[model samples]
Target: MTLFFAIVALAFAAVIFMQQPKFGKMPTGDRLERIKRSPNYKNGAFQNLSPTPSFTDGANFFTVMREFFFGGDPRIKPTDTIPHVETDLRNLPIDEQVLIWFGHSSYFMQVDGKRILVDPVLSGGASPLSFTTRSFAGTDAYAVSDLPPIDYLFITHDHWDHLDHETLKKLRSTVKAVICPLGVGAHLEYWDYDPAIIHEEDWNQTIALDDHFMAYTTPARHFSGRGFRRNQTLWTSYVLQTPSMRIFIGGDSGYDSHFAEIGRTFGGFDLAILENGQYNKSWRHIHTMPDEVLRAAADLKAKNVFPVHSSKFPLATHAWDEPLIKIVQAAEKTDLRLLTPMIGQVVHLDDSTQVFSHWWEGVN
Candidate 1:
């Protein structure tokens, strides 16, 4: 009965594979009930600000998969090691507010004496399996040990790239509190994080972080999921208002009217950190193209903009350097100030005269 033995072995393998902790548990009980009450939830999932599709017209999943595997450009990833600056984060002056990016969407900030970490996928890869979606050379500069105890950890959604299970597991003791969109707490809770320290909110909801800091959860035209299912959790952008600065932490959004609405509601932002990479024409509705990033900055009326979501993983078919090159070109057409800091380099939050070198140049 060789065939019978093979079937039994296959079933056992499938069961073991499904038991990995990274798959995470879904929301239930009160959490599910609360999610059901959200105004944006419909048809058993969360909805975007506008009707959105995972793929553009005429681009189906199989066709896109074929292109990704067989027909994409070879230079989509860099051939040389990326250049970066390594600044010791813990010793930075607390009085001086600054930002230090750790490539991709991970960054650390100190604004008005509060330390903030956002969407940190710092475990060197963005996928559940360590081999896939690995960070580019020299981009995995920061580990969990590199960070000081964080005051607030903000998670925009439950996507593997953003809500990394390995990274979060290591950060359990260091994170003071977590702020994420609705239903994302289930994953954190499943990973042994304290439920009391995790705060979940719906869009348009506001939370007072302390006497001097407040955060407003805003809408982003994106979807969220970590597994076969999608959009079961709300995706969000955020407005961080401190005593002296107002920053827009745009998690990940496609081009939409929500940016202008947010600007009007909050009277504009001092700094806007927007997504500007991992985009494909086939899935343009969930991620911003380079030109759309500039338009989004204009729509937000951001006095200064830092375009991130590039220079880390080769998530799309474009060359790793393309997002930066296109964004620089688009920025020249507008008067808006652009911040392009190297990974781990310090960015002064209040210094208007500060300038960063174009480090992306001369790199292969």
Candidate 2:
């Protein structure tokens, strides 16, 4: 019994070590130091724009144990399977734009006829091992091969769900350029991505693609790390501005004053893709609740709200449908236009009259 227990302890330690964020040799750039020294570098937004105080490390061991061993309700059965959608890469037209949500923070966005993938994680599970973690309830929507040639890839942070090394390795050859926050390029570099093709930006700094589109690194109320050293790197949201429209992609943020600040700076957004799932009271300040999401939509003065980061992973104690239920109820009360697209459905932003078919019913 003593030997068996010792083996189990060592195994657990090995898992922790594998999950830690591996920082690479620091690159020489002024923006890197500027971001690290900034107060909002670790946390999203400027110091004055933060809604809550900083997080203090506590007894996360109990939290982890409770979640791992005794977390989800067994009454919830695994969702039914759905067919994956394949994108036509050979003859995609330049005028037509579409965005496909591949569950959680992963998305395949066709903007201005250009293909851009954000945080693509196609692994069987979101945890250290495939057998242990709860897989997403949504359909296995689309595989990497089905995707059109990716012109650009954006990473919000180094969290397992947001940045998977396996996904990066698969896409390294095909992707044109990778846009990321400071220090994130190190992970890509480690994965063998060419340094010249990686562009790192600080908060509020803009990267211009052309006269029609530009991307700005915005604020997110969250920390970044895969292991023990938290807040060593930066996390961020993104603002994609086109000639006629501006879109805000809220990577993963708790409710913060920065939403309003972003709105004030950009005037308003045509669409806001905000996180609306896997939230809990224990980390409420890092992940916005349903009510807070509504407030964020209002703060951004967005014409439409597309909720992401939920409907995929069972990372919290809430039921599979809880976030959607709360969001729909809250939207009715706040007069917000929420677009709930199916796993592979294409949403045309110019049209507001498009109907949202309830696709998660069979799966949920």
Candidate 3:
């Protein structure tokens, strides 16, 4: 028995030794100092919040272990597996404004002849290990190679799903500027992006793109970390305002007073894209449940709400389709306009004629 226990311990130690380091110190210099000292720099609001319930309960480990060793629930359906249709941007006139959902929090927004990619993740998996589970439905939609020249790349945080190192490396040269929350530039810089082109903003700080367009880093009730050290960096939601339109991108957040505050400051929004999936009672302070998402949209006084952060990875214990179903029901109860677009489908902001199809129905 002693010999067997010793062998098990050795195996565990070896696994730890073989694991790659998840984080490292970012480069510091005069440039970093200048950015840090800027008046726009605000301390990360969520970092100081009292700890919320754990997202994962103690039973999660055993359940996951059982699933790994022996297949558990197979109810989770695969993601959309249809090959993504690649359209020619050059042929289409650049004046049309369009938004395409690319699963999870990723979206391709074309506005005023400029193209922007938000939280783009094209990797096969979100975990550190390649062998782990992946998106229930395979992403057959456009890969990184299908993207045209990106005018701006916006990131809300450094979580694996939001900030993919491998994808960033591929986008380094093609993207003009990388816009992110404070300290996220460090990760991009480490990945070999031009430090000069990486712009970092703090909560409430606004970056003006032109007279017609601006991006503001808003507060999100969440924590950040690539590994064990939590809150070393900041996480944020974003408010993108243009002369003709206002859009609020809620990166990932728990229900908080900040949503109402944002509505007051912005005088409401035309649309609010919010995280609506991967929630648990254990981590209610960090991730909003489906019902909470509807409440947030109402707090923002948004005319339209689009649910995201689902249909990508199985990070929660709930059934894969629960988030969408709950969100739809909540929106109905709240009298909010819920826009549910298919993966890789385009949404025109100016037009309300398009139908919100239940795309996940057959897929899930």
Candidate 4:
């Protein structure tokens, strides 16, 4: 009887803990109304283009939880600090076209005379609590202070790793515009962002960022939600057409027909930044598997593929370096160029011929 009470009390306390600001509020009032009108929203939540199961065949909730929490690959994290190169991004010439990856799914781009940041989770961790899902060492190369005043801040979704409350709060002052998928602006508004700066759009919609740049909200086969009530918001990829280059920001998705569809629509891209790590067989329907990365890149007809979503947080049970090793091997057999720069290395956007060292080779 006493144990039962203790369990209930602990569960109740956890519920209270989740109410804190970092968890963020769901869309309410007008925001909910707008979300309801989205073609992607249905059955009281957002739906993927394809019917994506939460887990693959032979994988159930209990088995997945057991493997993920207690058993899986032994090398969940690297032995040494993850390698990196730090640069003062703001000091770069305004006209210089460049991109810097801050590990995992976060990156900064200075292209076409605009400074853009995507999924900037530089708070040293990817969870509401700092200790849980802490970033790999040496990957916390930049704080919000290090960024230049951002011309555009692009959030792919509202997952804690991608849409960190602490990081977003710090960036609010400098960010000129906030562009995100449908229903994500609710969190930004809860965090006190100016609603006028937030532009939320559904899939297949395009917003012109001034006369030279057009931003298209595209599809990905993934579901979204921060709390237990899932799919309250949309997950998305983006196609950015600048004056001289076209870029694809693949927020997160599983392998599906959408890749070919996007390629057909956009024709091709100069660069496609896709998710390529923290994947497992259990949740294969949502995140891309190892071999699928290269295949997806090929389907997109991208000139160069920069794989992110790894080497930062141990969000899956695969060996820390498996994504890079496997992707590189697959890439060797194909003509497509795979960009695998170290955590903070500068990728010169104009230099398509620029070579990135296999930085993951020596690190344990």
RMSD of 4: 1.1
Task: Give the number of the best model, judged by lDDT.
Answer: 1
lDDT of 3 by residue, 256-298 (tens): 8999999999999988999998777656778998989988999
Backbone clashes (count) for model 3:
5
Per-residue lDDT tens digits for candidate 2, residues 1-364, read: 9999999999898866675433233333754566557756545323324545443235265774586458755523346653344555435676776777777778877777677888888765666555755555445646666766788788988887888766777777899888887777877887788989987876888898766879999888887776646666678889988776788988888888999999999888988999998777667778889999989999999989999877666677777667777898888887778988766777777778888865656553
TM-score of 2: 0.85
Model 4: per-residue Cα lDDT over 144-207, one tens digit each:
9999999889999989889999999999999999999888988999999999999898999989
Question: What is the Cα root-mean-square deviation between model 3 and the actual structure?
Answer: 4.2
How should the candidates be ordered by lDDT, best one leading?
Answer: 1, 4, 3, 2
Instruction: Locate the minimum summed-lDDT window of 10 residues in model 3.
Output: 40-49
Considering every candidate listed, which one attains the maximal TM-score?
4
Candidate 3: stretches off by over 4 Å: 1-74, 77-92
Better model by lDDT, 3 or 4?
A: 4
Model 3, residue 108: displacement in angstroms?
A: 0.5
In model 2, which regions exceed 4 Å deviation? 1-36, 39-68, 71-77, 82-91, 362-364
- Assess candidate 4 and give its TM-score to the true structure: 0.98
Candidate 3 positional error at 342, Å: 0.8
Query: What are the per-residue Cα lDDT tens digits for candidate 1 across 1-364?
Result: 9999999999888768867998787889999999999999999999997989889968999989998888777878888999989898989888988999999888999988889999998888898777899999999888999999999999998887888888999999999989999999998999999999988999999898889788999999999887768888999999999999999999989999999999899988999999999899999999999999989899999999999999999888888888988999889889989999999999998998999888888788
